[model samples]
Target chain A: MTSANSARRRKPFPVHILVFLAPAFIIYTLFMIYPLLDSLRLSLYAPDVNRQEVFVGLDNYERLMTNDLWQPRIEGAIKNNLVFFAIHMLVQNPIGLMLAALLSSQFIRGRAIYRTLIFTPTVLSVVLVGFIWRMILSPLWGISTDFLDLFGLAAYDKPWLGLEETALPTLSLISVWQWVGIPMMLFLAALISIPDELIEAARVDGATAWGVFWRIRFRLIMPTVGIVGVLTFVGNFNAFDLIYTTQKATAGPNYSTDILGTFFYRTFFGVQLQPGNPTMGATVAGVMFLIILAGVLLYMFGWQRRMLQVEF
Target chain B: MKKLLALAVILTLVVALVPATTQAQDKVTLTIESWRNDDIAFWNDVLIPAFNAHYPDIEVIFAPAAPTEYNAALNAKLEGGTAGDLITCRPFDLSLEHFNNGYLVSLNDLPGMEHFGPVARSAWITDDGSDVFCVPMASVIHGFIYNQSIFEELGLEEPATEPEFLELLDAIKADGTYAPLSMGTVDLWEAATMGYQNIGPNYWKGEEGRLGLIDGTIGYDENGFVEAFEALARWTPYLPDGYQAISYPDSQNLFTLGMAAIFPAGSWEIGVFRGQDPDFEMGAFKPPVPEGADTCYISDHVDIAMGVNAASQHQEEAMLFMEWMTTQEFAELYSNALPGFFTLSDHAITLEDPLAQEFLSWRDECESTIRSSYQILSRGEPNNETQLWEVSAQVLNGELTPQEAADIVQSGLEAWYEPQQQ
Candidate 1:
């Protein structure tokens, strides 16, 4: 009798709890969880004779890391991915930080207009963005040269998108243009959240405005900075859409811009020149997953501690 | 306990009801997955209306995905076992594997294959001749489309031989009014298609030569293909400035707007040129072969085709749609929309564009032998297009010597075929 009574009296979940959780749970599970789990399951098997997928243990990963045709692609992709991520960290984040600092200044007028204008690009679809930039940079149209010539920078311009040496970096800058707004908004939010009294206290101690910002505001926003850094790392590692849109899966100019995303796509779907190999694709995706996981772990364990502040 | 009971009931009911709801009966929908290139506007404005008028029972939906997206989405659907009932199969589509996977129906068994031309049937039929995977939708011919008005103004007669062609181009270039020829290399295949299609089979083995290529008797660097590339590379001096950076539409625009004298393209561009400049005096001609070459006709290959999904519930309706699509009555309807698209159905219809009509007449009058595009060759074997793509780009960029490119293609073929010899 006591057991039955205890079971019946167990903590009640209100009707609203079910109502609130049901929709989200169904969406997340159906869209995200199922596909993820299915992909993971598919990674375990390799296709064999009779075109049937048979269990192959870790052979797919082994072949991908050690095979002649595939090994170079994997190493090249990793090196290219690191280079891409580094460029974004050095160029994109700094530009975004500078823009945020400038926009958040107290004397800046029409801040809302500037913010909206800057954010508008990030809202555009990557395909539309790619086409727009392609047209602007086209030598056929000469719009980019004409526009640059008005500012007397015509000498600085070339067919930047077509050259092998400049293609990846040019694409990176284009990406930076589109995505800078996101980090800028993050920095802006963080900047606004810093207590003004801390800066005032620093100023009262004979600190200059720049010193006050550095000593107080910057320290307080270290957690936000760390978060932005981690976000950038994850985002760059998973980057596929922009490169796919601009360069196709091959990431052209003789594949000089072939990063991990393009490599994964080409392996997964196969192109005109190759047959689609699912095992190879899964291996590439698995490597990408490990890379992202590692970056996230570093942020969570190592950087998280450094960003922590204790109040006296 | 009550809350848990409610949660369990809700979950059970949802899972149970999902299957309980059968596909709504008496509903028939046919989706054609096509690209957003030349066919998009025509399908929307003309094809859909004509189709709907003929068969009110079935709704035709033009669900366009761009080329890359279309391929990926189609592959996923095929892999997921939910591909469209009618899908566009490009020249390089991996549909052979899709057919093997039981994704496509045997289109040969469909009701009306007798009406199609031999080339059309051959393009889509299985190698064993037991089944047809698709019905050729229309033919795409690759050749030089010239501005007739510009030629007339320059007093340049169409060249009848290789030397005559070179002399004409050199004269045009020397006059300084326009470049002799222009092509966009951004697509990577435009140059090769121009070179290979017209001359490949001639140098190859006539019809037997092509068969040899297929059966591995002839090698990839078969002297014929190399000869074609070498002849094509000589024209680089006459092409437009920054030719490598040019894209497809930009080249079309250049030809249409009189920025250039000639544009190399498939016959599909006739409608675009007509739309862009109705008064433009444009006509298509077969590119001249090198001196003493056996082939003279422009290569016209079967283009996009229709096929029924094997797994479709409405197989009968889908088959009916495909048969109806290829008839003379339907051909007339399509011709009314997209002029310059050729048909073997012998449709007696008035064309919208006179220039297109002239080109069609010329095609009919000239008994010149034609060949298939390189796409057809590469489609049968893996990495055919890849090797071709790289070599074409290298030839254009002058990065690879002609002999080197030939050796590369030969090695590529050996990698795929040599193992079979053992």
Candidate 2:
């Protein structure tokens, strides 16, 4: 009887744990891992003269890196993706952090209302956001121009989405506007989670309001910042819908706004007059996967190791 | 055991009668997938009724997708082995790719294929000329659709020569009353339609220029293509400010609303143009050629072609529908539905719309050779049409010279061809 009791106490290989996990595990494997592995496998082959898929083994990757037709587009897309991430980090995160700090203060009234209003845009569809912005900024409609005119800056109004020099930056800023709410909410949660005693102590020690944030609250929320940064990085690299909806698959006005996501889309699905090659498309996806994986690894090992957790 | 055996016999009898009952009904549904969502009314009001009247046993279902999304969706469906019985085939590389993949059923043995002219048939004929894959539906003539009132008000006649066209653009620019061209480069394909299709054939004429491209003997940087880009560049100044930001529909609005003088578009847009402005008087003209060119070439090609899916279970019914599409009744219905689209029927159909009549007049004149757009002639690797469109945009934006634009296209072509040669 003691042996049987001990055996029960030992967990009996935890078969029920697997039973609980089986559904989610099967779903994740079937939808996520299977498609990813299949795409990776597809990257090794290429279409021949007869349009038959023939195994070329790393040839698609080699061509993507070295071939004149694809290399420029791939490199340009990667460069744009980096810029996209950087803009979100520099402009979006800082602004979001500032907003969160302001909203999280004890003195601030109607904090819930402010939070709801700010977070509303994040819930709105990207397509709706893109269309609204496109119309607002349209040179033909004069909505943006009229708004600028109110501030005596009508001369500055140009086709911001059309010009090659301004297109990518304009698109980035638009994206930042829509998504800034996400980081704001995250930072707000992190700020609220911080023990109020630490901040009170900092204030009692003759620290300024700014000093409290800089010395206490900011440091405690570094983990959230790291999480937000990694999330932004992954999200920016995977972005396609906004640019596609607004600028199209060409990422046009001479592909000035072309990024990795749009590039991957074009390479995989193709657009007007261009035929899609699944192998090449898969190769682009694999490359993007590696790039995202590198960014994640860098965060996990490099940044995460250096980050010291603060205990209250 | 006796009861179980009796039940099994009854079940077998019921199962066996089901097929016979279905056969007695003799109902076969045929699905046709096409990009002509705008023609849904015609399909419902005309084609379906006519088809049902002739053969009530076969029911036709028209599955329409938007032009932009059709190819990719159809490709996915075909690859997954779940495509429609009758599939719409795009001209050029897409159709060729489908044929090469053995996804298309040959229409060579189908009756009424002879109604299609050699040019129409050529669009769907296999690379090896072994079989024709699709039935040609309609031929679209591409050129400039100009505001008749705007032209009259400005005293601008139809420019018959390249120099005259440039002169007319200058006059319109100087007048400053309206944009000389309603160009929507935001779509990108518009630039190709204007730069390559409307102009390239004027430079690259005859079998030598056409076949030379496939053989790589005639490069895009040659004088012919250079002149084409140069011509497109010359019109840049006359385009609306921020034309690159304009979408296709908005540009058409510009033309129809008299904000712009001209819209470079296909003949198929006539219906939409008329629908937009009932009283608007629009005139069609073939884009003029350079001074020394022997004959002007108009960009004309088969618009929508129908092909049977190789994996279709009901191909005979699908083929019957396709055969009926070639009949005079169907042709009249199509022409009546879409007024401006030219059909491939030996039986003459009268064009009622004045603008369509004007376009047909050009066809009857025979002074111009009808050529497929450069987009259709070129294969879809290194994406020549897209490359040309990009370069043209750059040229218009003053970032690249016309020569540089031509060179960029040539380089792209070389990149595509050199690898294939290896």
Backbone steric clashes in candidate 1, count = 1
Which candidate achieves the best TM-score against the true structure? 2
**TM-score, model 2 to reference:** 0.88
lDDT of 1 at B153: 85
Q: What is the C-alpha RMSD of each candidate to the true structure, in Å?
A: 7.1, 6.3
Location of the lowest summed lDDT over 10 successive residues in candidate 2 chain A: A303-312
**Against the true structure, whose DockQ is highest?**
2
**iRMSD (1 decimal) for each model:** 3.4, 1.6
Off by over 4 Å in 1: A1-27, A66-69, A151-156, A204-210, A213-216, A270-279, A309-312, B1-118, B129-137, B161-167, B175-179, B194-209, B304-337, B344-382, B417-422
* lDDT at residue A236 of model 1 (Cα atoms): 91
Separate DockQ for every predicted complex? 0.20, 0.57
Candidate 1's residue-wise lDDT over B1-422, tens digit each? 23336545544543564343335456577767666565777787787777777787787767677665556566665665455678676543365556766888877666667777555565666666577687666665566678887899899887756678789889889888886787755556665665555545445534555556656676656576677677667777887766656666777777777878877666677877778887877766666655776544445566667677776767887888888876776777666566667654544555666655655554453322234323235542336666676677667666667778777776656555543232
Q: Output the lDDT of residue A112, model 2.
A: 94
